[model samples]
Target: AQSVTQLDSHVSVSEGTPVLLRCNYSSSYSPSLFWYVQHPNKGLQLLLKYTSAATLVKGINGFEAEFKKSETSFHLTKPSAHMSDAAEYFCVVSLGSNDYKLSFGAGTTVTVRA
Candidate 1:
């Protein structure tokens, strides 16, 4: 069985400060990991993905994550936080290709203090 755990339920940061959101996952096989952000009453936006390819993956909005197999972790980070970055983030794992079945971790809500 595969599952993901988000370390923080909520994170607060001042605008322009660095942001970090931790996630840990367990998989039976090589897993496709993703970070998705959801704004108030909106759909999810892909932050990044680890698809058995690159260890360090760069994403939109100055976000990035490193896939650490040994640590069984994929943590999202940003150089500076923006007020618009305030939202809910979910760590997800895909079971297989062509299958949209995604297992989502309990979300982490980011609060950006202006």
Candidate 2:
């Protein structure tokens, strides 16, 4: 079993500036970690994932996440924030590859300023 926590409930950044969303996870077995983003009234979109392949995983829209086993963290970052980046983000964790159970974080709301 695994669980995830998004450290910040809300984050605000200026357009064209860097953006960061913190996430931490706990798992009993090897886990598959994923970051999902959802715009208002839209389905969640996959941002990135880490499945024990690489410690640093890059995703669409210039987003990236680094998995740190020692720190038990998988924080997401974007070099430059865009207006479209304003949305809710979730941190998800699943147990084994075949495991159907997925734990999700509460979500972090990102607000982009001009």
The top-ranked prediction according to lDDT is 1
Candidate 1 runs further than 4 Å off: none
lDDT score, candidate 1: 0.94
Show the colliding residue pairs in model 2.
none
**Residue range 11-100, candidate 2, lDDT tens digits:** 999999999999999987657999999999999999998989999999999999999998999999999999999999999998565656
Clashes of 1: 0
C-alpha lDDT of all candidate models, in order: 0.94, 0.93
Candidate 2 stretches greater than 4 Å from native: none
Question: Mind giving the per-residue lDDT tens digits that candidate 1 earns over 18-64?
Answer: 99999999998879999999999999999899998899999999999
Candidate 2 RMSD to the correct structure: 1.2
Residue 16's lDDT within candidate 1 is 98
